[model samples]
Target chain A: MEDVTTLTKIQLDALREVGNIGSGNAASALAQFLNRKIDMAVPTATILDFKDIPTILGGPSTLVMGIFLKVLGEISGRFLLLIPAQTSIKLLRTLIPGCEIDDPLNMGEMESSCMREVGNILAGAFLNALSALTQTPMLNSLPSMTYDMAGAMIDNVIAEMTAVSDKVLMIETSFIESEEDLKIHIFLLPEPKSLMLLLHKIGVN
Target chain B: MSVVIPVGMGELKVARSPETLVVYGIGSCIIVSLYDTKSKVGGIAHIMLPDSSGIAKERLNPNKFADTAIPALYDAIKGESGVFKANLHAKIIGGSEMFPPTEDYENNIGRDNTAAVKIALKKMGFPLIAEDTGGKRGRSIEFVLESGLIMLSILGEEPREL
Candidate 1:
């Protein structure tokens, strides 16, 4: 794998373009689901080297929504959605309208269903975009959900990816939908040799 | 008067009045509550890990680990209002398996935290009155001081008395 510092400019541009398309597709799908106009804006993509994940995420408090996609015969990573606790609750309420929670909140079937559907939609859209850009057939695994302290989440993701691939590249993006801003982080993990193959395909290295 | 004691990570709070002791955002952490009806006193400890013996030996705060926090909670309630008894009722919440993969590291923390609390309570001769735990979600718990009632709320579930 090339030094992460060297690929910043190129990777950032590629990721931003990819995010723009993916976010657009997701917004359309969500809008249809809600039967209302869902405005989504994709901000510039930020590159987070695996080592700097904690710093990029700020404090140890983070709500993560991760999506895993298999692209180019390799299982790459994508953080299709991420938000703070405060934002997550608000988004949950927005997605499931009129869901009233009492003092001691317990998640019921309706709320779980809503979150799962949202994860599926976001992961589907993002994977589709990634496949089209890479000119490779991509398949996505079932979406899994979890929440944790930011540091623990980042550490777990990195550790898990490293066990599978030699190097992992992450693409980070921010989105504003229905006046709610959220973070979307996508990870691309390729074995060293596979990464070289991908770069050759893209005419990069 | 209803006083609200918000317990953070590695912290414990005790109240004697008809107050509510709560802990929020309990992801992969344990929230243990000890209530004594005779004195109308309750104590809560929000612990992050199962045991303190392995990691960060220097940062040994009794309230930070289930092993130590459980004992500290008992002592605090006893010392504060003479409510410590082996038969004190206990209710626990917020040990959620909030990770996607079953074998993943993130998933183990909650399990470990829950196991530690259970062990500690058993060793101290305390019986668990009620519990709501082990799910892929977050929880907020409130211990009503007057009635020693434990109420648990998960993200999408209805609030129920434990």
Candidate 2:
């Protein structure tokens, strides 16, 4: 189940469909909150070697802002929202007036909670779409926020995740805020067994 | 000028004098650095899991698990320099708990990894010299064989040698 090669074209397409709907909903949610337009690139679901993951968000040393959530319930996995450092600062300033962007490394309670709230909203929308589409029940843990090197922020999850399966099914979606093209990447990594169950639920199995 | 070799996840590498080993962006993963001071030779491993027990063997790279990677790394370093056992010493780094403890399945993999690396090193008879671990930050490290010094770099903090 960890091997993407075992997944047929139909199954992959179905997974992509999941990403599309999920991200599409998430994008609209953000757009409404910001009172503007947001665009999402075509979502992709790919099976990746654990090593290549760091390169996905620039590199292992690339510093960024990350919000993590553990999906809870029958179809369980992990959810991640990654925003590049500069973009995170800009978004934070926009959300909370007078919020400091000068130091991307330091964040007060207000800033951290703001980011966490946004994370819950976006992740909520995405998961809600998945639940509706598959008629499955699931929820997410309270959001945890951190700013650090991309590999450091993510490798731990990959370690815990890949222990069972060497491969990861990354359903990724990129949100582009049409005006400035601020980009945010959302990733949903399904546990091995959960992925199989998801495919079956979506009629792909 | 020494050439630096980068060790990625689940990878193990050995080098001689003037060569350095680096592991980038380690969180919850443990970096085990072993050096033979006499020969100025070194080995590094980026171990992702505590051990390989109960994990399926198919496609399992032994180098990623602490229990397996330590012995294999020691052997490789020993073969590289033909150094005797006494000269080898170990320094470990990067076991930051990325998230606070959650459900047991999502508990502190970083803590588990650090403990596992310690047990493996002890059983193999390598003297543990120094260590920097257990925080809530990500780190990148470079190991210099010539001096057996490790330059530990954390995001938004000053780099220190261990």
Instruction: Name the regions of candidate 2 deviating beyond 4 angstroms.
Output: A2-4, B102-105
Model 1 stretches with alpha carbons more than 4 Å out: A1-80, A83-143, A146-173, A177-205, B102-107
Number of clashes in every candidate structure? 16, 0
lDDT of 2 by residue, B4-115 (tens): 9999988899998798898889998999998888889899999999979987777777898999999999878878746778999999998897766545565788998999
What would the per-residue lDDT of candidate 1 be over residues A6-106, giving only the tens digit for each residue? 45577556545666676677666766765656665554654343445545666434444433323325534434355555545655676776966432135
Q: Specify the CAPRI tier of model 2.
A: medium
Q: Please give the distance, in angstroms, between residue A85's alpha carbon in candidate 1 and its true position after superposition.
A: 11
Candidate 2 yields a Cα-based lDDT of: 0.88
Instruction: State which candidate has the highest lDDT.
Output: 2
What lDDT score goes with residue A127 in model 2? 96
List of chain A TM-scores, every candidate: 0.71, 0.96
